[model samples]
Target: MATTTTTRSFLQAVATEEVATPLRVVQMEGLVILKIIKHCKDHSPSLVTGQLLGLDVGSVLEVTNCFPFPMREDDEEIEADGANYQLEMMRCLREVNVDNNTVGWYQSTLLGSYQTVELIETFMNYQENIRRCVCIIYDPSRADQGVLALKALKLSDSFMELYRSNNFTGEKLREKNLSWVDIFEEIPIKVSNSALISAFMTELEPDTPVTQCDYDRLQLSTSSLMERNMEFLIECMDDLSLEQQKFQFHYRSLSRQQAQQQAWLQKRRAENMSRRAAGEEPLPEEDPANPIFKPLPEPSRLESFLITNQISNYCNQINGVAGQSFNRLYLMKALHEE
Candidate 1:
């Protein structure tokens, strides 16, 4: 088995090296692509959680920080599984055909509500040209999302780093000049999970123009109307989360986590260094035997950024795909009011 594995690895490397860059590049001409990310934070202090959306070439993505975790265990586990699966999807996109045509949407179902999976499936079937392109769930026929079905796709370590560029940060909203409605007509919203679709349709009443319904009647618990759906959603989330933590404990890295710890140590060192420069004594080192310095229940560093810049960019990206241009920050502000 070891010999065969080595042979396969060698062949893959050789194949990659032999293929010319131009030839290897996937030809994505008329294809519309959507990009999703797990951001750390958002513009608002109270908002948290990352987003999933389509990319806009002419403008940036509009992201927000409202990552609601799954209330149910099963739902949480699946989302955790989806998060890991996303790493591979990121890699797969690098070589595939890419174009200026992009759309952005956020995953707002909260974690674990396998209902979001239904959203994705719906989008896939909504239009002939549209593809869900999720990072997880390799086999459509499988009963459960398998871990091994994940395929490795290479991505640049610097991809997310590009958000820091002046263009991404400094650009102002081009408001009056932007037109978004033209692009909205192109998308086909497919429905795969009928239960979710029916539920949403029943709740969604026709209001204004013949356009799509953007607002959801999130009828709070005073009425039984929303109770059944809400309870189911939360339960799915909790289950999903537990499974995710289990997978992380079993398959995730010790070294990588340790390195995160090391980075924290370095940050503390810097804080101490500055204090010492100002004439204060630094604190004592953490005892190696103590478990106090260990990883905690806190969110990862990625979450911190997702809540802010990442969230804003994600939101704006959707506008670009919709053919409307707007300020990234303003989009989030507008989205919040609704």
Candidate 2:
């Protein structure tokens, strides 16, 4: 009875606590970062996801640990097994006195191709249980270019509200002041290490000024990355054009319906005038059963917005990689001349 009462009190405290604190930073442990990197790199080119465990502090999410989910087929029974596995893992961690609270999940992306409707749906699912959550995206392919290529992202508040309502019409989007770029907000990642680990890393530091990582930064091979980005960008542009065609078709149909309705109304008015002139009761000006009077549904703009966002992301990636590649080539040229 006492244990039950304590559990109830704890639940009440958590329920009453404010969950609207906007997350400003993601403080991740160095060990957790290494684990994520290893898990992602181990299955490169094949996407993988893992759950993050952490504590939610004021304006900061401290990610202390994480565990990878086993890859399984998409079946009902398999899904159930996956859920059971997650619960078992959490229970085991709790036994070991570890922070087992689910903060979010991390996933591997190929060349930064992580923006999609599926990702948005995943965010929505996580947000349902956790008041605030973030997806840590690691692009293993991009990391080859000497960049960490890891980022934390969450759906913007306005975007989430609009998504929940399932309304992405032009008027609603304008009212919310949400554009394609406003869909996802990226939070800065701060790596934290314990004193012992910090000291260990300091001892491991090399005496040489130039390291292999510096050599990687100067590598002038970015053609493949740029090619892939351009290909994806072109595909997105085609998709955007198709979405525009859908809106065009809808508008055309709407205009034709309006024209038909106007003609029918004029004909009814003329008939009513003749009946009145003949000293008879005129018919009603409006007919509820008329097919032309039915309102046409507007096409949803959500898909188009996402496609545009993806295109912008691809463009930015290409731009950054190309700029770096050019600088590297110039440095190489100067070194050869010297």
Candidate 3:
């Protein structure tokens, strides 16, 4: 009976197709945001991840609770160990009488370098299990720059279909009309604070003396972020160039081998025909131990695509930061003249 029930659940999961839902709006509780911010800040410089627990309504996923995962080896070999640890944590959460069901997961990213295969694979797994689950990316580095960068994202329907097919060929992409923009659907996040908490915060607001803040927004510290982004973008370009060279070399080698194989087959056929014409038994046909050529294995292009996407993201971020910095500089100049 247990096996039957398991089979039925599996069938139900497979049969349910995720429709193109309306734009998701994430309603995150104030406490949930605080916990995530604290978790990310505490684990700065190293990527941190946690699970979000909440209820999902038709258009909004209300996140109420979260807990950070235990630190684990980042190597792929210990993935199973991490999974087991998460399961144990989930069991404990169930005992605590809190919302333990995983509505989604959250990860900290530096300068938005979150578009990797691991993230996509994790999201796929989570969405497969819970269709409405979203991944929240917290940019701690950006947050330190006086902006709380929290974005809730989900793999778009077309992107999920393309990924599940595992066919990223040019033709397939064209058929699906997929692009980098289609990869992630960002949901607007609204922080919901209780009245009591709001009152408490308001009561504490007057504890500090009010003073005029001069040039707070005009700080040029954004230059450092812009520099780091440029450096990373350059490195990615170098890696992309190397990947392109590798693909070119592979294709050239493959073409040469194919040509040699064709020539060798033709020569053998000619020899066989000549021998038969001479009224002699054709030489026993057998493939040569060392064939004329062997094709090189095709290299995986997934990493190349991911790197390209990351570079694009960096460019977008740089543009935004630069624009804001320019506006600040203009304002500062105007204020000084005044």
Provide the clash count, candidate 3.
0
Per-model TM-score, in order, reads 0.19, 0.92, 0.77
Q: lDDT tens string, model 3, 106-147?
A: 999988989888899999999888978888999988875567
Q: Tell me the tens digit of each residue's lDDT in model 2 across 110-195.
A: 87778889999999999999987999999988887888888999999989999999998888988988888899999999999999
Clashes found in each candidate (C-alpha, N, C closer than 3 A): 58, 0, 0
* Model 3 segments more than 4 A misplaced: 1-23, 74-97, 161-177, 202-216, 265-297
Candidate 1: lDDT of 61?
A: 25
Off by over 4 Å in 1: 1-287, 291-298, 304-310, 313-338
Q: Regarding TM-score, does 1 or 3 come out ahead?
A: 3
Candidate 1, residue 255: the lDDT equals 56
CA error at residue 304 for candidate 3, angstroms: 1.0
Report every candidate's CA lDDT.
0.34, 0.91, 0.82
Residue pairs in steric clash, candidate 3? none
Question: Candidate 1 vs. truth: CA RMSD?
Answer: 20.4
Task: Give one digit per residue, the lDDT tens place, for model 1 in 140-234.
Answer: 11101111111111112132123222122211213222121211111222212336655776689567654321222111122232243345445
Off by over 4 Å in 2: 1-19
What lDDT is obtained when candidate 2 is compared to the true structure?
0.91
